[model samples]
Target chain A: MLGAATTPAEARAAFRGGAVRPTAGIAAGYVQCNLLSLPAADAFDFLLFAQRNPKPCPIIEVLEAGQLESEVMPGGDIRRDVPAYRVFRDGELVDEVADVSEVWRDDLVSFLIGCSFTFESALLDAGVPVAHIDQGRNVPMYRTNVPTRPAGRFSGPLVVSMRPMPAAQVADAVRITSRYPSVHGAPVHVGDPAAIGIEDISRPDFGEAVEIAEGEIPVFWGCGVTPQAAVMASKPEFAVSHAPGHMLITDLKDSDFQVP
Target chain B: MLGAATTPAEARAAFRGGAVRPTAGIAAGYVQCNLLSLPAADAFDFLLFAQRNPKPCPIIEVLEAGQLESEVMPGGDIRRDVPAYRVFRDGELVDEVADVSEVWRDDLVSFLIGCSFTFESALLDAGVPVAHIDQGRNVPMYRTNVPTRPAGRFSGPLVVSMRPMPAAQVADAVRITSRYPSVHGAPVHVGDPAAIGIEDISRPDFGEAVEIAEGEIPVFWGCGVTPQAAVMASKPEFAVSHAPGHMLITDLKDSDFQVP
Candidate 1:
């Protein structure tokens, strides 16, 4: 029960006591969020960036500057809750650690963004096969030709995660995912890598590439990596984010966002 | 023909030349927005307020500080586009004018918020008769006991607009309006207004009260005026907003938000 917690609070508690690993399969039924903390000076700009591009940056919750506990996840300390965190300075990754309390600042404003894992779980629940999850690999992510609406100094190309499914089930997959709008809802693109300016399917900009079988086509959903890409491009003097694949498990269940 | 323009641009052009009045039933096919312009210093707080209370503050577009034109309504001027604007200083109305060019500042950020007109249009299109519109009166708005999630200096009671429909048509109205998430997607309450702490059924804090016919239920949806209430309560030093019922007609159509 140590690594396999059933609730988000338990999972966060476990991670708080030095559980430094990815959080993919932990707290299975809860909502997992992508974390982004920026200095108060830049919070408005980044928030505007998220507001302009909601598909890739669907905000779940925003903790006011210096606020530790989220209303959604009460008594949870964001600094010590996540399994791993990556610290950046001048747009470069300077440190990756299990606890970010050492570097946390009073003026840092945190944003919890919706992740694809919730929708992927929904897809799996609906019997739609997720190729990357099936292969025990990371979902394929690519940089697209689509430019995000710039806000202040933050601007970047849209990043998307691709999952291949049989052409017959694409409609069902879309239907299932569309219900969870807060979690990067619905596929942005369905059939072509070249259409969104991707040169190769095998090599992804982030995450591991997976196989697309015969009779299957690549479907893309707006990835949460987009804001990170903006942080890299815009070079916001200081920032904090969850490490790749490591996420903050929130107390809310996916059912909360299931519109129907 | 001059006052009966069918396009958003033409309607805005007419308003620019001192055609000051309410914008209901104008350019019926397009969307109308509630305008809220604040200085750059208060932009973040207001934006955060809108984000936290999205049901009542669905944003259509945000024009940055000093930015004149919106990408959604190119060739349009923010100062001269709307039929009427109410200028407020320290939360008290100072003037109501058609053009705000003289009072406009270089650091003012304007937010175009989704108005109920779009969804009301959709509801009427779906054959769900709206009571207020039937009587040619304003939708009754109430100050609910439900407190909105506070953001910075922005916090106030959730204001809701009521529409009475036959019990048989309530479902259709909800189903129809739910598609337009950008313009208050679904009803927040149906039936007894006392559930949300409304002491009087006939009295409303804002807008005109209309009759709830026999066999009809009083349905309430989040209203756009919630932000104005916050402005009144929080008392920002300076703000500009659309006069009650006077909205900015945008180029986008209601169908654009009519998600299937």
Candidate 2:
């Protein structure tokens, strides 16, 4: 098991040396970010899209044209820093690669977005059970009826990830997670799935469904996959993103994101 | 005096009808935002700059290439909504106009940025004296030695606005304004002006300087003018911004921005 004691530099070094695996539990105390790289032309629209839908796409760092290393995560290379990257052309996934140095371009703008993983750490610390981790499964995600405010060429519905917990623990879960607004803060909906247009909680649109014990309720938070969904819908000419669960570990601690 | 009872729509109508004045007291309860417009090409860079340096340039709303109305202040027109605009070309101020309708272009992108005026109201409400308002002078502004993170072509020294208040009230002033992060939040520096590179407490780079009483400390917050200074330094081919004290009024109340 990759323990919480690992530093962000260690995790990135592992990813750089052909370690392709989920980043969960590695560098546990630090922030793990979602990656989105696009050509300069489409960069503005995507940045605007994230600005309009901040909950799902809380921006941690943006590496602009001609820049490869992040200011927030110094010494990390954007091209080959992550363990895995998904390449898409005209919105279709074309390749999943371990290294993207060959495809890196001077005009490519990279965005490091906050992931829900940071807040999940806070939840676990506060004694709120995360069902998927206990069952060794991916957290359930759903495309909701809620529409994100459109920006330029991007327009799509809000996407959310769910975790089931005891009804009594819901308030505590909300209070804990709300402190990290950059990492998909607080539950968007608490009790009913159908209210947000998820007809059946048993089948999720992405990731595996987890069991909800008796006296427990399902809670949803804005998911990081949301911006990817919007990118896919818009079908941009070219784009790159970190594969699900394979995030870029940053030097920043999870505590750095907490509201003071 | 324009009272809190006035709506965004009503205030906009007054601006549209050639009411050229400071927007401070006009929209008593609503948010009044700083305006900056540029070509769509420069829009991404400016937005990225704001994202990197959020404290000084908190984006209240951004209108993309084709859009003219803001989502936050619905039904308001971007071209002529604000009472005044300062047109710039290659870093030099060229014109000051009451309406930008004729100058508006299809490719122009508009940004509505949070102004410190919103939080000044909060400070006053908490019984913390705002020296400039009480004495009927412009809030003192200075360009600090601190540099803002560069985004694309936008980069410059951090600019801050100052207000003098009793040393005992500094904590309460911070507590009240910290709730509104969308505006410049809390004091960037307190007690020592020279620490941030302000040579003379009695002189300011922009706006009128007010007296700092013996018992009061000069508190500084990130100023909204920082973005404009950045724009000027970058020498973007073309740009439009509201004259310093003039602002675009939004429907969102000052309390709407409070995090808790």
Candidate 1 residue-wise lDDT, B1-260, digit = tens: 43435688888888887888788878887888999999888888888889889899998899998788876787899999888899989888889998999999988999999999888877877788988889999889999999999998889999999999999999998888888788989898999999999999799998898987889999999999998988888888989999889999889888887765
Clashing residue pairs in candidate 2 are: none
The sequence of per-residue lDDT tens digits that candidate 2 reaches over residues B1-260 is 34567778888877888888877677687899998999998999899999988899999889887787866768878877788999989888999999988877889998889999899888888899999999899889999999998988899989999999899999998888887888988778888888999999899999999988889988999999998899788999889999989889988888888775
User: What CAPRI class is candidate 2?
Assistant: medium
lDDT score for residue B23 of model 2: 76
Candidate 1 lDDT for residue A113: 97
Q: What is the Cα-based lDDT of residue B95 in candidate 1?
A: 94
Q: DockQ (Cα-based) per candidate?
A: 0.53, 0.76
Off by over 4 Å in 1: A2-5, B2-5
Candidate 1 chain B has its poorest 10 consecutive residues by lDDT at: B1-10
Q: Can you tell me the DockQ of model 2?
A: 0.76
Tell me the tens digit of each residue's lDDT in model 1 across A1-260: 64445688888888899888788888877889999999988888888899999889999999988799977788899999988998999889899999999899999999999999888888998899999989999888999999999999899999999999899999998999888888998899999899999999999999998988999989999999998889988999999999989999998888888776
- Model 2 misplaced regions, further than 4 Å: B1-3
